[model samples]
Target: MSSALPPASSGQPPVAASPLQPVTAGILTALVGFGSTFAVVLQGLAAVGASPAQAASGLMAVCLAMGVLGLGLSLALRMPISVAWSTPGAALMAATGAVQGGFAAATGAFILAGGLIALAGFWKPLGRMAAAIPPALASAMLAGVLLKLCLSPFTAVAVAPVPALAVIVTFLVVGRFFRLWAVPAAVAVAIGLTLAGPGSAGFDTAALALPKPVFVMPAFTLEAAVGLALPLFLVTMASQNIPGLAVLSAFGFRPAAGPLFRATGLGSMVIAPFGGVTVNLAAITAALAAGPDADPEPARRWIAGVTAGVAYLGLGLLALAAAAGFGASPPLLIQAAAGLALIGAFGASIAGALKEEADRPAALVTFLFTASGLSVAGIGPAFWGLVAGVAVMTLHGRLGRLTHP
Candidate 1:
């Protein structure tokens, strides 16, 4: 038989040579999204005092939440509306460290943040207010939060030169040829080194079993509400959700904003009891599903979103294995991998923070204060950083008026 397409007999669109283009793109999106950030998610949860089992549960829960929401919304709206866990919020948590009530309080904060997101969707003014936060200050806070983590590669080299060099070299070489796969490549090398290194002695084979969700009854504390919840909500909205919408709009798909936010917010709340943090729109990975690479026709790209959801569910099944793998790795190795994954984000945030000269001074103040790691009366630096920036801006405005008068 000839290896060729059969001619269309009647009125119909030509069947493409390969029907799996969108499916391939969707799978790639899921792979890059999960492999690139799951380490950060685990590190963040662990930093907040979660046990290994709880971190695995959080990973599984977030994967499932994003999968369900992305699939459902894409089907309902007929648009490539991808969803993902809040990577920036997780980075913020990693920097925030443990709060007063520990992981339980962090769980409560997650719920509160989810509630705030849902409320923002329902009450337009709240959403607008969240949007109104100064871009410079917001970017500065994120950059500062990322500063320590982004420095992990050099620190890792100091701690373990051989393994760190291997990981870094892999990242650099692969990134030169395949930018999207760079972190994943480095992550793969780091995992292999962990298996071969002394850290493997503590590895527990039992942790490789299929994961069961671990529920932590939330204990709300004032410290967590201010330091963790508010900042998490702001970062997820400003960095992930808003940018995700803009990506889709750039691609010419304009779905109603309210329902999408509500869906992610509600999904996040539902999963919080099971140790999950925030889930939101996919910012970096959304382009994979929404772009022309997914499909020649924009209308049919929803299939890519659906495929990505299915792919995420499949990856969630491996959460336990992933946790086990990381458990065998040195903490610095994991940190290095997470940091490499975030280098692009850190650079972008720095650029955004300094974009407007008028906001530069306040942005610098915010960045320094946040990176200082100072705490006062139980509140963390992230919360106070915004306050410091605003105070400087106010003072500067008053001084300028006095001089002009």
Candidate 2:
């Protein structure tokens, strides 16, 4: 593993430069880049019965809202930060609604949660406290969260071997030559095959349409908000922003903690009232935008994120349909592409954790706990790993003190 690099704000801070010109082309390219995430969103809608029109409309709403916010805020902050609806949160809500009421109330819950985020961001102390978490813990949490998504492609291969293999092979080929457009190229191959026949195999060419927002008046209920808000915060922090910070730091961008949290907080507030839940800084996508492929000129990568945002706006209307769409197939192609795309990131995370010898045990524990696929008392592995690692470390240190004395 490479020696751990200092945090973005740790080393010499770059002379803050003027914002790069918006790269419309790169932005346009990135939307096509994250095609799989879009697919997953569609699949979630399908799970929710997300219906045809509502699915379409909700997806468009999510895409557009996220995209617009991502572009505007990213540009405003002069950071390559991107935005996306919380995938983990959406899954939670989809499951929640299935047993609870419906999406409408859940969306209402979404709004309340956004308010909580804004509160967290508004108070600088809380944000700083969050940032103070040990680097290894944060990295482990991120790796564990993403490892699940990274490994999911193999399952896809089982369902649709031929198509998945094709996608993987194509991705590897494009990765060798095209470099910048590698994963995108793989996705193109997958989309091409799917449209060739069977499931959603028809090419329906229609120019994209903008989303019409539906405002759900905030009905403040402690029951709804209490149930929904904490979970939203947890998903955003653990699944969304934490990884985002990891990506930012990985690519040598300074982790400007305050503004990033503030932006997510505010963004969540805007869309939560309308039906968008779990909006947060898009760490995974931001890595895609900030890295070499985002743009030849690193300065222009924010535009890639911006372009993704615009695509989000365009697709926001079909939110549920989008999730269903991804889940619709054996999803071999999506899995293949997403896995190949994240390979670089996964490597980086593992490398990051292994750097400090003292940190290795904790990191390994985290990775195992996360990859173990264990859930206890209704919480995921992230919390559990942290609990175990920290407990062990504290006890070991105390025992050493006692022995020395």
Which has the greatest TM-score?
1
Off by over 4 Å in 2: 1-21, 25-29, 40-58, 74-116, 195-259, 273-277, 282-312, 315-324, 327-329, 398-405
Per-residue CA lDDT of model 2 for 90-149, tens digit only, reads: 543433333134455555666666665666677876554454555565556556655756
TM-score of each: 0.93, 0.68
Model 1 misplaced stretches (Cα beyond 4 Å): 1-17, 398-405
The predictions' CA RMSDs to the true structure, in order, are 5.5, 7.1
Error of model 1, residue 218, in angstroms: 0.4
| Candidate 2 lDDT | 0.58
The C-alpha local distance difference test score for the whole of candidate 1 amounts to 0.88
